[model samples]
Target: MAFEVFKKSSAPVSTVPSVTIQKRGLISLNRAAYELIGSPEAVELLWDSDRRVVGLRATDLANPDAYPARPQSAQSNRGPILVAGSLFTRYIGLDTTEAKRWVPQVEDGILTLDLKVEGQPVSSNRRGTGESARETK
Candidate 1:
């Protein structure tokens, strides 16, 4: 008489990792991992395009998973939207006046503030003045 032996597969099963994204463009991270990264203004997300990190975006501080699973971080400064420059317009023959009106636009993870002079849109730079001020952050 001959006996047959049944063998089980030896290869380990692979599973997809879980990822969460918020409407405000913040990638979700576990509490422990967030703390381990020094609580930066933004967390780096890696995309497997070229086998390395390709880009960086600011994390939404209001994401629920950020702290205690809250819906928003209105009371915290974890990822505040920093003003890159002074909200003012320098016009020729006119005193420097603060931008009375401004419009904000966000596209592809970039925030652009379109400042206006007395409700009229104007470029940030002075047209004729040689003054060139570059914003540094």
Candidate 2:
């Protein structure tokens, strides 16, 4: 059947003897005799990194009659959240100056602390800064 060729892979392309995608959809063939026509797109999309792939909404049907599978090297990562205030704000403003900081009250638990470059508190409350940054509410 005539499958709209997408980006060519590094592998070989299958050359069908004859194929057609018309109003009746894709049709498969055997050179001399057997020809079977399908009613829908020959290749079904299975999964995508984003909900909309190539700017068009795709489906979860990858292959017909195929079992659930996972692509090689597929993964998702969500880290932590770090609350930061502008440097212009007073450093003490981030300390126990208000009831907002739980670090001062709960020193035994996951209490946040001050971040200073040389000696001044930058008020950068971060955990594994680059690694963990997603906040969950």
Candidate 2, residue 126: Cα displacement in angstroms equals 18
Model 1, residue 56: what's the lDDT? 24
Give the runs in model 2 whose Cα sits over 4 Å from its true position.
Answer: 1-77, 87-106, 114-137
Global Cα RMSD, each model: 24.8, 28.2
**Candidate 1 residues 9-64, lDDT tens each?**
11111221112222223333323223333334543332323322222234555653
Q: At residue 42, what lDDT does model 2 achieve?
A: 27
lDDT of 2 by residue, 10-71 (tens): 11123322221111111112221011212122222122223211011111346543222222
Q: TM-score for each prediction?
A: 0.23, 0.15
Error of 2 at 10 (Å): 36
lDDT of each: 0.28, 0.21
Give me the overall lDDT of model 2: 0.21
